[model samples]
Target: MSTENGTIGSQGEVNGDVMLTHFRKKDDDDANGEVETEETQVYIENYKDKLLIYGINDSPPIHVTIICALQQGLLSLSGQLIVSLLVAEAVCASKNDAFKARLLSSTLFMSGITTFCMNIFGIRLPLFQGAASEYVIPLLLMADTDQTFCTSEPSKEGGQSPVPATTTMSPNFTNSSLGNYTNNDEITMDRIIYNVQMIQGSLVLAGFVHALLGFTGLIGVMLRFVGPLTIVPTLTLIFIFIVGPVIKFVEVNWGIAFSTIAVAVILFLYLAKYNMPVPVWTPSLGFRIIRYPLHQVFAILISIVLNWLLCGVLTYAGLLTDDKKNIGYNARTDARIQIVRDNPWLTFPYPGQFGPFGFSGAAFISCMIATLISVLDSIGDYYACARVCRVPAPPKHAVNRGIMIEGLCSMLSGAVGCGHATSTYGGNIGAIGVTKVASRHVFIATGVIYILFGIFGKFSALFISIPYPVLGGAIVVMFGIFFGVVISNLEVTNMSSPRNIAIFGLSIFIGLAVPTWAKKHKSPVQTGHAMFDKIMSMLVGNPNLVGTIIACFLDNTVPGTAEERGIAAWQVSEEDERADVDRTEFNEGYEVYDPLIPRSIMYSKLMKYIPFLPYKRGNVEKELGNVKTS
Candidate 1:
């Protein structure tokens, strides 16, 4: 092993099974060339002062594992449900309670499947995968521009369209004759189904492209040009552009919405350090009190539950309005109660469950753009997760495998008609930092729990029945966190430089301006070809896409050194030829990310030649020698 002092063992002495531990004497050597070994405690210098309850590779007791898993599962589930609800609203499915419930169930199921696969075979990090808000931006844009769904103008005050009355007609009607149409509900259902099918097809195509990028090692090449400057504006605009949707939900009942936001803000910020004493039982210690950060760990969930109860009580007391046309009517707890009764007890989402898939060039482009952003965000998430887990940064091969798996999961999501892609949950990573539990076993168990909950249709129905105001409150806090996190990327760049400031300012300004102008002036891009015009208009109108393209163009072309542009720190070397001692020492933390397979097969000669494998041919020989010697 090697440390700051020096290497402590010969090459043959390195043992793969040995846990990483190092010690140093407090006092220096005396004048006689002998060490002055003072009486001192031998502490693990790698994690010294961190006091982590569980490390990346450590497996806790079964009970502890289940409890931690539940916490993570709930946090991820909340985010996924919110994204599903937003997609439902965008696609004009808000009035169809059964369809909304099905959408929620599908999203949850896919998230569980993806999260499960990610932990075992993907990056092997303690990160949760869920429905991403990034894709929602494009979905919203697509819905707004669709001729079938844009027959009526949305309300100018709240940006919400009136919810159509429920109908009894089946959504799977195949009659294409206009004479078969009985009411507007039939047309609305057909449009929603068609749009969902289009999304599924585009997601499948986009996912294939995404997987190719990873499997071919193109993602690493693309990262060479990406820096904080490009990421900051792209991600910032993602959250900022979603304000219209959040406002639509929040305006349902400002009183409840603001209350929810206030509770979340207070719990997450003010009461974060405060701990609650909880009783615990163990085989050795019968009963014990443990200090848990309950508020910090469950800030979002608690706020939703508290406000939901409040809305329920107010509804029972006849305080909330029941009038369909009145404001704040959606805040009532019974607003979507019918969904709970309509949903089945169990739902197993399968491919082509919705209908025959449909393809669209415009939708494909939008999904591809969103997929690129998801890739960039996930790369950053990997580094952040590694730092929080106190492990070495993930190697390039591990990252490629992670991206490949993510793309496959998105394909699965599309097949099931979830209308969104899956990405790493940043909130769960933040929970790891607060709870100090980064065990992969815990996350794996959490994935199983997610699968169980996803199959229980009633559970998903209950979350879908959450009041719009409460959801709005949660969205405000959730997206607010998302915006702040991405904006913090600015810390890595030379913010003091006028060049950077000018680039950021111009990109954001044009990003917002172009989209607003396009929205006001329909058919702004008047190319002779209708399809080409629509695609070009969609690309230019999206704030995130515009800002990303502008920022990337400026950052790459502008004259600046790598260090000044933060590229030096942002980019990790593809290969590091460290000395044998240093390589063994670093592997202690990195081995946690290795694939769940026999080392004999993983480091075999044939496997070493594969670009996506974690080990190289040269390292295989050295690793085999160490194994044989040990």
Candidate 2:
């Protein structure tokens, strides 16, 4: 291990036992990539009060920061685009172009602001925040409950149809202005507006619940029971559940899908080991040549660009068809050009941009379930992200604050009529691992990029046509790596033990199987009460939640010691070489109070005893006693 003075030994960081390995290296050299400790010391010292990373404060050049930010920002945009489109189709019934445009603008705006909050004050990591999939099922259930809101007929001008059970609605429904709709069409718009209002109200309420969970410190206590076994399957299912969507896109154009996938693999895997020398000027050091992994850094974006170029060439050659049904149709270029021509150059999204808000019991209950799932999934993301950044697991307080920030974002989404919620994107989190660029400043730049994209409506619209197969191919690579990351957490666990194997095996099998079956069957889970049944069906229907719950429950209930379950080794301690030995250090780098804010509740003894306050200071035994009771 490297000494605290920042000197390295010849042995280097290594371990033999796979079942007892820490996820990240303890040495500073490996932890901070090529950047030295003194280079990042100023930023870390400035934010000494919070849990900041070398990546966040490591002052990369302005151009490097912008490039990294844009790269990570694109990954986040892909998820937001998918969710915004789904909301336009599922909730607006492919009829209200105004609502669709408003939803897209609002989410883009909300995501930018929320992500800024998360990086600065919440998780204090390089995690990219984006639209979450947890709300999709609940929103779909809400739409199904009121068919009038989503009912549609084939358009006279275009081949517009109702959102199919097998496919998302085509964008052709959002080609005109709301004023174009006839008197009868206005009535349909009214119903759709009402439905949108109900969803907004429910999400607002759910956000409050999320805040309560964080404030009461209940989330901290819950974290005690979450082990690597539970996390492995939970994180794995996130990617596994995307199989349906990936298959749908791949089936559309196998050639494009294969090409995109091939490029991503070649860049990410094949070229990953090679680094190119870049010249840089430093005041003290004079000049230096840094071997940067340029190819791997731009792998995902490069793969997409290569595919896009091929598609454009085919389009020019007249080999690409205009028919939507044809496999050779260049949807990427066509959609981009069309949206740019249709939308305004600039548009600003504000509160209540769509219509008035309303509430429904069924929608509210379903949203609560969605909130829980989002929280659970985010916990796994926190761990995985920390691992990639070469940091220890976040402490109770940081996790609580992270969720609270997400709740705030959710409320903002509801207010803005986004019809969906925001959460940390696992795909982007995994990218931190793939690209090995975990700079906090880069992500801050990403937030700025998102905001700029949102403001320039035409600018955002241009990317709306990103080829489906290219995106699908990228999804496959990201999710595949995410699954590998989840399994890596199990390195500390005794995989050879039949008991551990059974726990992981059963949790994963059921998590994937239940959701697949539920989606195919489309049968409502009955619980006698209508509202209760709707909620149950929504919760049970989601694959990620089902798998996580099963794994968490079985892992805790089953008989085994902490070591046998890998809990002991998976966590970090003060003795670890990478850890700071300050008494205030409470699991990882997260402190109990913000040094910048003296009047913060963290300073109060009464608050410390409240359990979820994350207040770890003097009179520790008293605080523990109070925690057990409160």
After superposition of all CA atoms, the RMSD between model 1 and the true structure is 8.6
**lDDT tens string, model 1, 1-630?**
655534354323422222232334433456654664433222112221233557778787787788778767755655776688878876677666566677888888888898899999999998889998888877777666655553332233434333222231224322231122323444355556666776788999898887887787777677778777887777667657667767877999999999998997887678665666667664743666655555665567688889999999999999999997887888999987777787778878888776667676777988998898898778777866775666666677788889999998998898888998999887677667655678898888887877877799777667667888888887677656655555665766788998899888988888889988988867878879877776777777778788888988999999888877777755645354122324322323557667877776775667655545665445666777886998
User: In model 1, which regions exceed 4 Å deviation?
Assistant: 1-53, 60-68, 71-82, 85-94, 146-192, 249-275, 290-295, 324-327, 387-392, 433-436, 574-588, 605-609, 616-630
lDDT of each: 0.72, 0.67
List clashing residue pairs in candidate 1. none
lDDT of 2 by residue, 234-267 (tens): 7677666567756765666678888988987887
Report clashes for each candidate as comma-separated counts: 0, 3
Give the lDDT of residue 137 in candidate 1. Answer: 74
Worst-scoring 10-residue span by lDDT in model 1: 40-49
Q: After superposition, how far is residue 369 of candidate 2 from its true place, in Å?
A: 1.3
Candidate 1 has a TM-score of 0.78
